[model samples]
Target chain A: MDDATRVEVAASLLEAYRTRQPIEPLVEKYAGLELDDAYAIQQHQVQAWLGEGRVIQGHKVGLTSGAMQRQMGVDQPDYGVLRDDMFYPEDAPVPAGIFLAPRIEPEIAFVLSRDLTGPGVTVAEAAAAVDFVLPALEIIDSRIRDWKITILDTIADNASSGGVMLGSTPTRLSDVDLRLAGCNLYGNGALVATGAGGAVLGSPLLSLAWLANTVGRHGVTLRAGHVVLPGSVTPAQPVRPGDTWTAQFAGIGSVTARFGQETA
Target chain B: MAAHEAGHLLDPGATVGPIDLRTAYAVQAEGLALRLAAGERLVGWKIGYTSAAMRAQMRVDAPNFGPLTDRMLLAGGEPVSTALTQPRVEPEILLILGDDLPGGSDRDRVAHAVGEARGALEVVDSVWRDYRFRLEDNTADGSSAAHAVIGPLLPAGVDLAEVGVTLIGPDGERSEATGAAAFGHPLDALGWLADALAAQGSRLRAGDIVLTGGLTAAVPLPSGARIRADFAGAGEVSVRREAAVPPSRTPADTAETGT
Candidate 1:
């Protein structure tokens, strides 16, 4: 409950994140506290950053793949908040130095035109709220060093969400069969991954439904213009300096970006 | 016996070719990881891709499962090696069966056989070349589960039957879901899972650990990102994400479909 202590912890964590240093010891320093208490303190830290002018841009789902579930030993996936400072143009060069730990994942991004709410929101209903769908990439970065962390560490780090690369195509949701949409994930010009739209819980729309009900339980609403990167079409791959990754959706166009070496 | 059989769903990854659930190229991928553990051994297993969300995410409709190696297991207060994995941390409740309940929609029997409950986090990592894999590729590969860091175990008396759990992110953004989120009461789903496994010629033994499914949505954890899930009195589990070098490329890379 010490504001200074929390800020100190948050600041220290952010530094580690920027350098990709380990944060296990730091997190353990605060372990044993109530889950709610731990989160409240962290929320304050992030909100403070937001108050300084960073806008909350979107959210991310990690461990959405089956491989992640088995590897991690948990059943479901996890989520993180996205901020405007984290987004770059589809072709932006990601400075690797800012991410303590970083990876690149190919994904499909959907922008909602209307607020999506539901205990009863159906896939059809969730899809109806979409404004445009873009082929995108999520740059995942964590504040923990050595690339090691737990749910608590990730939660405190905002779910390891770093930045997003948006495509320009802007396909209409109603015009496409998201379930059938497929993407070719290319690294350095070679196809490295391929997945159908169905890879994300049947369709990316299902991710929206899951988010709607999930956030609804937390008393939050899915506002319009919010972009949801349903889940990684391909498992995330490590990005070294100078690595370029791109995702081409069958009919939705594509998004691309490059990574620079960590400088900090 | 196919472990706890829930209603059988199709794991679309099966479309590429035959997948040896116990042994295959995918298992080998996991095997390489196991070898990386130095002296770790098999501990338990988990079911993945059970929900429609997962199926669609992978463009598959069935659930996938993976083994939990000994090195991956953790109890409350246990120290973790942050160097172990390129991790994604997730919260879930592990359901240990008391009596073998048939897998189907048999809620009553499922409710009765709940032996023990605990909150745990699944620590996952991507292992394919460049860390890119399709939904089916992940599904059949046991969902690329790297480890299962379990928390303090709880006795079977815990009435997790219908409790609400919250999923908090590293930055403290919060979300909540009920036990019902896993198709409602994963224990009930366990019955069906058990039955499904039995039908497939397998059965979940007493010592087996069945990850009921995720309670909240999936969130990302960077390498070194730590995470946990507090299941009220059910105890909490922790995990750390680690960085991994890309594996050597293979022909599967050439045979990849739908790209």
Candidate 2:
């Protein structure tokens, strides 16, 4: 994709989000959306949103799990930025109609106390920067129609992030061995998926470390007071109106996301 | 230099921000000092643009040369370890000196100093945007040198002028040339190199490796490209570029060059 197409695609994706009308996968139109082109398109939209008075909240890592990596045939994971509007109160009901096709995943979220800067940060170094960890439910909604997306499509769509719901408990890294922590996800009073923390790059800390190094090349710093969702520990399951999803970690806390039947 | 090697395109003309050859050499010396500071040893030198057509295209009167350090060598078939701004490969005959070549030596003495000859590939990258610059700019940019990949060494008797070179690209594209492309004979390039260096009060030393000028037009080496160079009667050498990363993503890279 060239300069013109990047700007054009960014505008289309932004319009789709505001209109609650998901557009076709960008890959269909661009046909040759390279990693750099997709990143450029994503940044164009990010800048536009910032101009509209949106605040950047954090970042997200996607395809960290071996299964996702293998499925996508990519050796490393892709990333996206998160904004202040993406976070929602855990106690309030989220409007289902706001998202075109939302899905839910459990993640180990890191809230940083120290800025993590690196093009070469180690997992040990990342461990030193964390303030606390929380159970998080990432409500991934695609601006691309039907969630049919390639890696480029998802990356340009801000890693398909819609909203974030966090658990109340804030535990330190030393308090829990997340690699051994198992998670059970529930939806509408029924079990939907089960996974362990090891599913996300052996441990969520490794994902955090990778995220820092990956973005650091672009001059981005994972700053203090920022939230980082390493990746989903389990495959994302679809969302429906009136559905309620809760993710419970064995040693960590649990986060619940209640959805409205439909927007008025 | 580090930024340029990372595929960062700098200003269009002079890379070192200096225009004169003296300043160009000084700027090059500054970069060499940094390499030495980082514990790299000077191993050899590489000459570029020896072909008549190349010199004409670049509008230069003579071939340019620059120092080759241990850090700039790569093993044959090994992938290029760093991202480069406009990386291209040029095939050459490498001369490993068994004895020093004294200043103003005749072609006989120059030929005698060669211990052996080998087929080699030099991966060249430009620091200036689009390689649009004066010869001084490229000279200061270390003759646009990134890495050298060597092939199997052959005894001193390999044919010089008539030796044929066949280059195959990763996608099976082919380019053909011969040793005569460099000043009608590879040995003349070596002789010119000695005179060029002697002008700067530097003389060839024993164990010094010298890369004669490119045999054919350079070809672009994209991500995962594997380029093979076959030098008739000497040996064959090849190089591969690592799988693609988004531009400007990878950090400092070290190691590549074959025996």
- The lDDT values for all models are 0.63, 0.81
Look at candidate 2 and tell me the lDDT of residue B5.
Answer: 41
Could you give the CAPRI-style class of model 1?
A: incorrect
Query: Tens digit of lDDT per residue, candidate 2, span B1-259?
Result: 6776466877743334548887787788888888888899998899988876467666777678888999789888887766675788888888899998867888999889988888899988878777766778888888888888988674356456545566677776555455666765678888888988888888899999898888767888988778988765555799988767656533443223221
Individual DockQ of the candidates?
0.02, 0.01
* Model 2: lDDT to the true structure: 0.81
Task: For residues B176-195, write the lDDT of model 1, one tens digit per residue.
Answer: 33344454347655765677
The residue pairs in collision within model 2 are: B73-B256, B74-B256, B74-B257, B74-B258, B75-B256, B75-B257, B75-B258
Question: Candidate 2 chain A, which ten residues in sequence have the lowest lDDT sum?
Answer: A190-199
Clashes of each: 100, 7
Tell me the TM-score of candidate 2's A chain: 0.97
Error of 1 at A59 (Å): 1.7
Off by over 4 Å in 2: B1-259
Worst 10 residues of 2 chain B by lDDT: B250-259
